[model samples]
Target: MSNPNSNFPLTLKQCRVIREIMKKGTEKEASSSLNLSQSSVSRALSQAEQALQVDIFTRGWSGAEPTSAGEVVISSCNSILQAISDTERQLQSNVTTLLKLKTYVEWRHLLIIEAVVKVGSASVAAQTLGMTQPAVSKTLKEIENMVQQPLFSRARRGLIPQTAAKQLASLFLRISPVAQSLQQSLQSLPNELTGRLSVGMLSFSCQDIVPIAFASIFKQHSGIRLQAMQGPYHMLANALRQGEIDCFLGLMRKGPIHPELIELPLLPAQYALIARADHPIHNDAKTLNDLVNERWIVARHGTPIRDYFESLFHSIDNKPPIQALEMLTFASSEELVIHSDAIALLFYDDWNINKLTPRLKQIPIPLPKPECTIGITLHRERQSTIIQTFIEELKLTIIDKLKTQ
Candidate 1:
């Protein structure tokens, strides 16, 4: 097993100062907030920078701005801090529990826990982690000992993550992405080309740009492995932030909805309210109001697209359909709407429509909302070479295929 100490190589003071600077925004601000001198704050920042071997902040007259590397460091540091806070709150740290945890708990334990929860089996986690089953078990036992609770309940099907395990795993999920992004960053240093790139995208991207980019990316670099995960924007955005996926390609709201992740526009996407060709309102619809009684299929709750549907109704000063099914896949929603008496709000794509044509048609509702910007959402730390390469191909594909549409 890899040594745990090597991974968590930051000092206590370094952890303290990362938050201070992130919150207060500058050495002077941190010093003033923490009741320390400016030089102390500077030293703390410098020490953290030296330990991390990356520029965590750009110091200038206007204030401190985080560079890409800084963004990664801050993200990872925030996870660590939050995890520590959770541990303290749950464990109620006495001298012994505190000392035992401080001495025994390492970054690897959380990694193993998260892997187990993700894959739902110790054996699978072992295989994924390239460790023996016994080794993964031993690590989980160690984690249980440190936390003084059973994390997983052995089940007939798989390990059933209990409350403690689930909560702890959730905290680790936040950290794992930063750790993963860091590894990807190291792998994709400007001179080297070896790395894995995973992009999570939704329907609009799948209709054209993403696949085209995928083809070009594979053709250019046989050595690199490329993967894609499809889901709604909110789910994929959570994945992107957790480092579950590098970025999510789809329709983005015009302004900044998420400060941690940035959106770069790829194409203009216009919406259409679609129903099965035999749908009652397909020919008669004059406005959104004509379809208020129809059933609806939508992206999962809290998703940008699903929320956009809500905003669409509010924009027209109309009440939306009362019912919803949280089907995140556009294809699945399309299939359901094609056969059932429901309608879907979708980006206008002939490719999406052409395959299932004669069965599905667009409602004649006059949509007054502005066209949505379809694009990719990149986390603050996603400026690495491999990610950049993939995004470049996506843009090129857009220019060739989707720019006009």
Candidate 2:
């Protein structure tokens, strides 16, 4: 295994010195601007070089110029600083850079980094890229040189990501989808569906509506790149408003939306508290308060189901369960209730009578009317041709499937 922290001592002071020298084209001016002695500026460069084991500056009577290695390191440092400034600007005014790679950080370098991290082996990444292992290794080394950090360690079978590598991988993952979307948008043919569509779906929609609707859409459109994210309604709704998700489907919230999301209501949903068929309390006539001490598993706080749960017992002296096990995935919540004594609040679609009902039984607890409002929501300006088509299909699906039910 390799050590990332070992023998790596580059500091912020050294980075400043490098940037100042690059901008000033001489150590004397860098020292003057930084309010430091020339010898201190020179020492900063020397220490950085010693740590990196590479000479980044060329010294002569004409003053110092960055060497080949120094140029790459300087570019990366500038990118890092520029990204930080952009983030601060966005925090204040919500404006961001409209272009990709204005800093010359090559996409190929990012691709190689992604492939290696995902595959965990340079050799496997090489095969996937149709390049030799040594070529991939050489590209990785160039990236390491630019960042001036060790990204990964050698393992018995593959490469293991160190802190630096993991950080880079995170950056690539965050931006890769955007890059692909941009590429598809720019290179698409006229009047054809060729772009990425990210949909945030709820558990109820995932079971039938989204799959059936998307399956039919895929049959008609070959260019629609679909990415579905399923979770609690609140999390998915937030993702839609933040632009992390393009659209949200399932139960819509009754609260007012910021940024003015356009909601397309499809149907109404009912919720019920359920437990394993063999649970000790299934045959009882107890109210929700009667099971106050029992472990209850429910959705995370932002969804309508959770909103209903809170509203149901709001009139009680102190209210419902002291603590409920919140879950994002219905599958996990179902398993938790099936094996343990935990009770789960589920939608009718979630505990379909065909499969899960054999193991789980409803607690016969009557919930309030109109427990949830089901539909699709997206930013008003974000509604596009593909998104509109998806919403229509979802509506058609609910109509067709509900009729059968």
Candidate 3:
């Protein structure tokens, strides 16, 4: 089997040795307790440290002690072991087979299992993992034999994961990003940060704040690589949950979010009603009621902005303009407003106002100031140094730009 670079750098044996040494306070005691030679225990620690690119332990005459980085890694090891034990007990499996799990289960095994469960076909999983279909089937068979349970049920369309397979795949998905983040954090230098930062951006942020933050990050940390994915909010949220993106930038969602993700509110943004600079309605529009008959450009239903737009007219005991164009992007909305008599709603910020002043102008109609907070969302357990630094830069950029406005 080909072993790729895994998010978790250490093997089960290495983690076991390190955990024993941490508990026993010496390699000799750990070796005796685990029925292994001192050199073997030492070798495991050496290999783990090399893979992580950090010194995990400092050896001395008294005993071997875990370094700062080692403590973090050791904690993760303990968590993994505890999770495995919990799974064994929950499944009520044979003690002997479960005990051998640590020896047989590798990161690659978990990767294959996760791929198979996600794609629901051995052949597709094999293609995704750059392996043959037969190799994938063989690995699955080996895993099933080891666990003494069928992980998947054969179906005409595709394979269906059993409860055990789903549980394992979910566990891998949650921990893979966290482990990778930990490794990157340990390997990064204090003065220079290095890693890939994948970000998901909504339409609102793509125009101004996110790009500025990216520029700031690039100037400060040239070693860091940046990727930005733009899509609808629901699609982006799903991507963030699957560990496909580091963080999401846009307007904060209302109500409670997923337990595994955290929302950090940054600044409040107000909305503006905009029209072409030379529109005849510009001078006559003193209230929203005055423009009720005019053509309007608004977001589609189910979007946060769309809800807000409908609520605005309802507050005045009036229905919103029936003659409307449903638009999603500010660029398209601005273009439609410039050529036609369609008034559009947009963010009323200095950056946006300055950009739109040349062709489009904000109407003077009075509207309620609702709290639309702009912020970032991130996985609770996967914060890395690169992600934290980028957030800091983003906060600074928002504050600086707003202050100037």
- lDDT string for model 3 (23-126, tens) is 88898999998899999998988899888887776542234556556767888788776665565465445434543444456666678889999999999999
Error of 1 at 63 (Å): 36
lDDT score, residue 161, model 3?
A: 98
Assess every candidate by TM-score.
Answer: 0.49, 0.51, 0.52
- Stretches off by above 4 angstroms in model 2 are 1-191, 202-207, 231-238, 349-356
Top TM-score prediction, candidate number: 3
* Residue-by-residue lDDT tens digits, candidate 2, 1-405: 122112224444566788889888799999998788999999989987886665676542234556545655566556544553443333323223242222334445667788889999998988887778888898798767655556799889879987656655666566444423432333343456644467877764555677888887888775565667676655666767766667877776664366577777777666878899899887764776766677889877766787777776774554766689888776778888889988877675522433454788878766667356677778887777888888788878877876665
TM-score of 2: 0.51
lDDT of each: 0.70, 0.67, 0.76
TM-score quality measure for candidate 1: 0.49
Pairs in clash, predicted candidate 1: none
Cα distance off (Å), candidate 1, residue 299: 2.2
Give the Å shift of residue 140 in candidate 2.
28
> Which 10 consecutive positions of candidate 3 have the poorest summed lDDT?
94-103
